[model samples]
Target: MPVSPTDPVSPIDPDSTTGPDSTIGTAAAIAAATIAAAAAADDSTGTDALPYAGGNPYADYRHGEFAFTALTDLADRRLGGAVLAANDELFAERENLLLPEPAEFRPHTFGNKGQIMDGWETRRRRGAGTARPHPTAEDHDWALIRLGVPGIVHGVVVDTAHFRGNYPRQIAVEATELPGTPGPEELLAADWEPLVPRSPVRGHAANGFAVASRRRVTHLRLSQYPDGGIARLRVHGEARPDPAWLAALGTFDLAALEYGGAVEDASDRFFSPPANMIMPGRSRSMGDGWENRRRRDEGHDWVRLRLAGRGVVRAVEIDTGYYVGNAAGWAALYGRDEHGAPDDWFELVPRTRLQPDAVHRLLLPGARPVTHVRLDVFPDGGIARLRLHGSLLDD
Candidate 1:
C-alpha cells in the first residue's frame, strides 16, 4: 500500500546601487557621485540584501533549496531546453514546464477540462482514485525534458509554486545522455540513471534534490506521484561539451553555452543573469542580455567565465546590440590560465570606449593560453553578447 504525502547569497558587493529609478544608467557621473556620498554618509558597507523582517508570508516562507541552486539552470528554454513529451497533460500543457516566467494563476479562469493553470498537470488516475491506496512505485505521471546544456547535473528544483492543493504527493527524477535529437519513443527505452529517488514534497514550495551522478546527461525525466501539477523544473550543473564536436566546429566562440563555456561568477544580477550573454544565438531585444543595476554607488561590474577549454583566443566581439542608452560606456577583458593562481589575471583588452547598439569585434594581439576570462564593464550597464573566437588546444 502507498503512504500519504506530507504537506511541508551571494557576495557583499558593497558599492552596488539600483538608485531610486532603475532606468538611470551608470554613466551619469554627477548622479553616481551623489548616491555614493549618501551611501557612505550612512556608513553602509557591502552586505547582502536581507529578507523583510515580518508580515510577508509570501516572501518569507523558506522553501527546500540546495547549494547547487547557485549553479546555472541547464534546463532553461532560452538555452534550448525543451519538454519533449509527457505521459499526460489533461489539465495543463507540458511546454509551460520550462517557461522563463514565474508560474501565474487566475482565480476563475476556466477551460473545458477545468480551471486553467500555467503548469504541466495530469488528470486523476484510476487506481489512485478513492478506490485504491496510492502506490509508491511505477504509478505516477512523467514528463521527458531535453537539457539545453548537457552536463553532469549537480542538483534540481521541482517548483510547485501556485500548485497548492494540486501538488504532487511525491516526486522523483532520472537523467540520461543521448546523442543528437532523440524522439520520445527512443528515449522511453533508453538507459536512464536515477538522480532523485521518490520522496515526499511540500505543497506550493520549491523541492530541491542534489544529484549524485557525475556522468554527462542530456535529458531528464520528472515523475510526480499518481497525478498532479508542477510549475517548473530547473537542473543546475557545470556544462561538459564533447571535445570531438568542438574540433569539428574549427573556429568557434570560446565563450558559448552550446560549446560548454559558462559563467562562473558575477558582480551583479539585479537586472539579468550573466549567463544570458553567453547563449547560443544573437539577442533579439534589450532584455536578451546580461544587465546590471546602475552603479550609483561606486566601482565597476565584472563577470567571470570558464572557457570551453584552455585555448588561444584570436579575436573577440563585445556586442552591445539593442542596448541604446544603457550600454556600458567602457569595457575591458582579462584572461587567466586554468592552473594559474586565482588572483593572477592578465590583460587581454585594455579599457576601450564602447558605442551603444553596436557590435564591437577586435582582433586580439597575443596568443595566451587561457582557460578562463573576465569582462569588466565601467560603472554598470547591459551587454547583449560576448564572443571569443578561437580554436581549442589539444589536451
Candidate 2:
C-alpha cells in the first residue's frame, strides 16, 4: 500500500476500546507536528463555496478527523497483537490464517476464504493456466486485511507490483464495517484492480509496485490468488490510531434504495435514493425527493454522493416530500459558506431537466468543507434518505 509520510514508531497498547484525543504528552506533540506537515503537502483541486438561507452552519463539524492518529493506532494494534502483519513469510503450512484476536470487522460471509486468513495456498481449480484463480473465480483463495482501526482513513495503498506470473488473476481491495448482517455492511467506495496492464511476477518485484491509497476506511479486505506464482501484499492509509482516536470507517446509517440498502452493491455513482422514497406528510405533493432511476431513461432523476470527508458544505439534502416527476429541471442547488457567505448558484443537473419517475444523478457545485449534507428540494421535490459519503483532509 502507499505509505503515508509519517515515519514508523513504537505503537501503544490499550485494553480499553477508546482512543486518545491528542493530549499534552510528548507523543501528542510529535503527532501534531507530523499532521501539520502532511496537510501542508497536500495539493487538491476543485474547491467552491455556495450560499444558504437558514440552518446550523457547522452540522458537519463533528465529522472532522486526522490521519496520523490512524497510523499510530494501526502500528500499535499490529505490534501489540491486536492486528496482523507479515506473520508467515513462508507459506509452508496449509491455510495461512492470520486473524486479529479480536477481529476488527467481520466479513459478509465465511465463504470468502481471505476473510480471516491473510494468506493461503491454492492451485487453479480448472486448467493449468499458471495456477492462478480465474478472473471470474467465485471463491477467494488468498489473504485479507482489516482496517478495523475505527478512524477516518483518508487513503489506502496496496503493493503488488512484484510477483511471478503472466496473466495474474485480478486482486480486489474491498472495505467494510463489522457485523455486516442485515445489509448495509460493506461500504464500498471502490473495488477494482489497482494496475491497468496485466503483468504477473515470477519472484520479488520492485520496491513500490503494488501500492494503493483510499479514504475513510474502517475495514480493509484484500482478495487475491496465485497464478502459478505467489504475490506479497501490504496495505497503507491515512488513519487514526487506536485507544486514543477512532473515526468510524464506513457510513453512519445510510440506506440506498437503488441497491437494496446494500452499501457494497451501491454503485460509486448515485442514480437515486432507495426505492421507498417519500417526503414527510407536512410537505404536500412531493414525497421523499430522493429516488433512483429504475432504468436509464431520458432525463432520469438521480443523486450523486461524494466520498465521506471532513469539511464545510454550502448546500444541504432537503427532503422534498415525493419524487416529483420532471419538476427538478427548473430547480437549482443552493448553499452558503462560513459567516453565512452567499456564493454563486449552480444548476443541480446541467444536462436535461429531471424526468418524473426516472432515476438520475445530480451534482451540487460550490460545496465547502462541511460535515453534514442535505438535498433541499423545492416544494414539489421529495426525498427519502439523503445519504452522503467522502472525507475532508482538514482535521
Which numbered prediction scores highest in TM-score against the true structure?
1
Error of 2 at 18 (Å): 34
| lDDT of every predicted structure (CA atoms) | 0.76, 0.30
Residue pairs in clash, model 1? 8-202, 14-46
Quote the lDDT for 386 in model 2. Answer: 42
- Using Cα atoms with residue i matched to residue i, what is each candidate's TM-score against the true structure? 0.82, 0.28
Q: How good is model 1 by TM-score? A: 0.82
Tell me, by lDDT, which candidate is best: 1
Error of 1 at 108 (Å): 1.4
* Model 1 error, position 355 (Å): 1.2
In angstroms, give how far residue 42 of model 1 lies from its true place.
Answer: 32
